[model samples]
Target: MERYVDGFVIPVLNEQLDAYREMASEAGKLWIKHGALEYFEGVGDDMEPDMDGMPMVTFPQLADTESDETVVFSFIVFESRDHRDEVNAKVMEDPTMDSDNYEEEMPFDPERMAYGGFRSIVSYE
Candidate 1:
């Protein structure tokens, strides 16, 4: 049973773009180095039509119009849920976690940052 960490990020201000990207990239690398089997990052773009006749998936739209225009998303996959938890605990304890350069510029409200751990229910490849 593989485990995954999903992070949904929205950059509400242009000023936070550079910092957010840097943080996401570095975090991906750190996860891989610390024990994650796979790491990936994705950015939202203009939606295109899909076969379903609906617009392609887009970032979650906030109710507040004042929200920023970009979203940064990333994930880390592990061989098993227990392994994932172990690695995550170590990652948190590692001194480098606190040294992340983008910490000061976290764009979203911490209470509102969307994130979770999930077990793989199915996979095609």
Candidate 2:
């Protein structure tokens, strides 16, 4: 079966990881509650990989992160593109997603965040 996913790459400050985690936890729950098949958010643990010769753009470089910032890679999965749209619409209407409820500003820079929707071309299990 083909799946739809919304991916995000965000640059977050080291100190704000806790806050980001808190927000992501709530958001993940909401996504699941709204019909997302799966939700994941992971912080950068290993930024520089030993390619043994091959060079490629890293997450830090892609996010343009500073020394004090780490990348937060997140994705939400759905059965299909229409399912994603339905779940997202419901999630947006949830009170917990409201920006007014937050005490502080967003943990990451919105302009630097990369977002995309994808359809799975392959799968295992």
Candidate 3:
């Protein structure tokens, strides 16, 4: 099966770092339970634009991040695109995935988040 991943970059207020971690941990567990092969989230330690003369698109810039905000990069892996669709359907149906409650509970602003789905082109054991 072709592997797929849904990646997200969220700008979180520095003071809410711990809250964001807790929220993400809960979401990750829920996603794994719904059939995600893997769920990973990481805080930014180095988020500078490339110096190699590239297009200069950094995570901070993509997230429209501010000085008081930090970047969070996350991904949920799936066995395949179809599997992703299936898992997401079940996840959304889960009671804990409620959007009304999510807004109040989430630690970051949804407007400043970046998200995308990708099919892995390469993999190594």
Candidate 4:
């Protein structure tokens, strides 16, 4: 079965958008080069959550009322979980991954970044 990697990123503020985008772009490229089947990024909108508690907008959603922070939802697809692990191992060891120079301006708290691997339950597309 196919596997996937999902990442939820929360940006610190609008000023951090460019740096975050650059980081995501470089990471996506590295993943693809290391064997990812697909890579994507979604920008958030200003819409609010619906009555069902689901947001009617994109990522970078407000994390708090007093904060300008927003989240970025991104993911990568792989042929299998094993492939995902293998590619990830290589990606981690690659020097390019460490070259993301925006360390000081990282949008979200690294410890809080949500990420995980999952088996494909179903895919329509």
Highest lDDT model number: 2
Question: Could you estimate the TM-score for every candidate?
Answer: 0.73, 0.95, 0.87, 0.75
Error of 2 at 75 (Å): 0.7
TM-score of 3: 0.87
Worst 10 residues of 1 by lDDT: 57-66
Candidate 1: lDDT of 37? 86
Q: Comparing candidate 1 with candidate 3, which one achieves the higher TM-score? A: 3
lDDT of 3 by residue, 30-122 (tens): 999999999999999889845887667788888888899999999999999999999999999999977766655568888778889999999
The segments of candidate 1 whose C-alpha lies over 4 angstroms from its true place after superposition are 1-12, 47-58, 62-67, 99-103
Candidate 2 local lDDT, residue 51: 90
Off by over 4 Å in 4: 46-66, 99-105
Candidate 4: tens digits of C-alpha lDDT, residues 1-125: 55665545554456676777877888889989988989997666643545577535334333331256666667888888788889889999988757584456555467656677778878767
What local lDDT score does residue 65 receive in model 4, on the 0 to 100 scale?
18
Model 3 lDDT, residue 28, Cα: 93
Clashing pairs in model 3, backbone N/Cα/C closer than 3 A = none
lDDT of 2 by residue, 34-111 (tens): 999999999999899999989899999999999999999999999999999999999999998777888888877889
* Candidates sorted on TM-score, descending: 2, 3, 4, 1
Residues 71-113 of candidate 1: C-alpha lDDT, one tens digit per residue:
5566778887788888888889877877563447565455555
In candidate 1, how many Å is residue 42 off?
1.3
The predicted structure with the larger TM-score, 3 or 4, is 3
Task: State each model's CA lDDT, in order.
Answer: 0.65, 0.92, 0.89, 0.69
Candidate 3 residue 8 Cα shift, in angstroms, is 0.5
Model with the higher lDDT, candidate 2 or 3: 2
